[model samples]
Target: MLIDLSSNENPYAPSCKVAEAAIQGLEGMNRYVEPEELHMLRKALGEYCGVGTERILPGPGTGYLLERVLCGLAVGRELVVLNPAFLSCLDLAARLCKRIVRLQLKPPSFEVDWTLPASGPALVILESPNNPTGQCLISREALKSLLKNEDCLVLIDEAGYEYAGKTFMDLIPDHPNLALCRTLDKAFGLAGLRVSWLVCGDAFMKALHMENVCLCRPALRAALAALEEQRAVLEEVKGVIEERERLKAALSQLGLEVFPSEANYLLVRSPRPDLGLLLRKRGILIADLSGQWFSGYFRISIGRPEEHQALATAVEDILRTEEGFMD
Candidate 1:
């Protein structure tokens, strides 16, 4: 069996409490999710986010919320995005927006420039701790500067906030043009449930009518249980973070270029351009970003220590056989 680490998923399984809740929820599958159950979820999420229930909007996932918001607000407006952002968001912008302005983040330091040009009626979308690169690209002061333009609406995707230990949710009350998109798929070990939500500001509340949005019964139950069992989730997250550091050091020791990551994965540049293929033959699966975005670059999700050992071994073998390949 192959150890798949293409997607940035938590290597741990959901807590027992979450599993039991999902089983219990299966009993009510015949009936639609009751409004009260949805309310309970929103209320739980609001409390977890330290915001009021009115500001929270639950959905199937962050992708769904982003699509709805983009369809409603991005039409006929300039959509600004980072080049190596989430692919789905980039595709959505290409289809839904009038024009796109891609801010290309250079290597070594994938920093972002918040000083956007004065364009009328624009929508700016950014992912902090951006995908693929696994680096946080925004600052509090830079974000605040972007929000000063009343004509520009800023949407920040904090999908990896749990691992990064940073968030801008507190600014929602003050900035009418700001919104945040988050998901439980990463740190909470609930990817299969597709549980996600949006924290909307006053302007977003009026634009996206999210009152009727609902998650499936099982997903709803699992999400509630996960939120309730916060201690176990935090412990698992701590474990993953530690393993990430160890893996980064291991890969760096092998003469591979490992970039610093604030997310649950690492972006690496290998000497061999076909590193992804070489690993696949060894029954290991990792994301090769070369075809998708850059050459000789790959993204490796944090996995079990044993799995990392297997990968390191395979890489070592490749290095020995391909000596002087880069010359």
Candidate 2:
């Protein structure tokens, strides 16, 4: 096994029920599908997300949902984003040709500018439980500050929400300017299905141009089955959590600075960036995130036990090599 840890995904195979469900849905698949076919998904997600059906919507994945959220609100002005945020969010801002105001996340904690400027018709984007750094998510208090301003539209993409449960979805009704995007790729293990969703006030969904959102139904079907099929996904979730705790304990023993990780990955820095790259040459697939805000650093996903052990071994080998190099 190559042990693909590059994309943070649930390595466990999909439920047997999921395959049957997709096949059943396939009988009518040749026919044109209804947009309201999204209802079951919305209902299940609402139950999981604690948001109402009117407040939620689906997409091919979180990326498509995020694109629509930005397209609907993007006013051709500035879009404020955190630097070294997820790469796709950066690409979307560029595609929209929206002038970006990239801000470096300040230390003590990597946080965003909650009091973002009201200077232009700006759409603010950020990832909570943020991707590479594995830092703490922005709080509801921070969200309140942005929503209170009323001039900007705040979009929080919690792609790793499975690992970090904290979110601003409950406040959606209070802030029409607030839009939240979520995904099943991480939590539900339907990445192959490419499932994702969006939750906003009814007005936003009504105003949204939803043509592209319809194409994700095949994956959405698997996603829905995952939700309704009796806690099938939860077992894998529990496994990942257990492995995460185990990995944390092992990495801590090595004395590397493992930053607080709310997601499936750990943020680890070295005395020099070379160490991250050196481990990579050994056929290990951990993330090496050096010189991009988190220079001299890398991230490794919380994988299955066997994979975790192999990575830990590679890391130990690297450390022993480094000690020899120094001596």
Stretches of candidate 1 exceeding 4 Å from the true structure? 323-327
TM for every model, in the order presented, reads 0.96, 0.89
Worst 10 residues of 2 by lDDT: 209-218
Error of 2 at 208 (Å): 1.2
Instruction: Score candidate 1 by TM-score against the native.
Output: 0.96
Best by lDDT: 1
Candidate 2 at 251: error in angstroms? Answer: 1.4
TM-score of candidate 2 against the unseen true structure: 0.89
Report clashes for each candidate as comma-separated counts: 1, 1
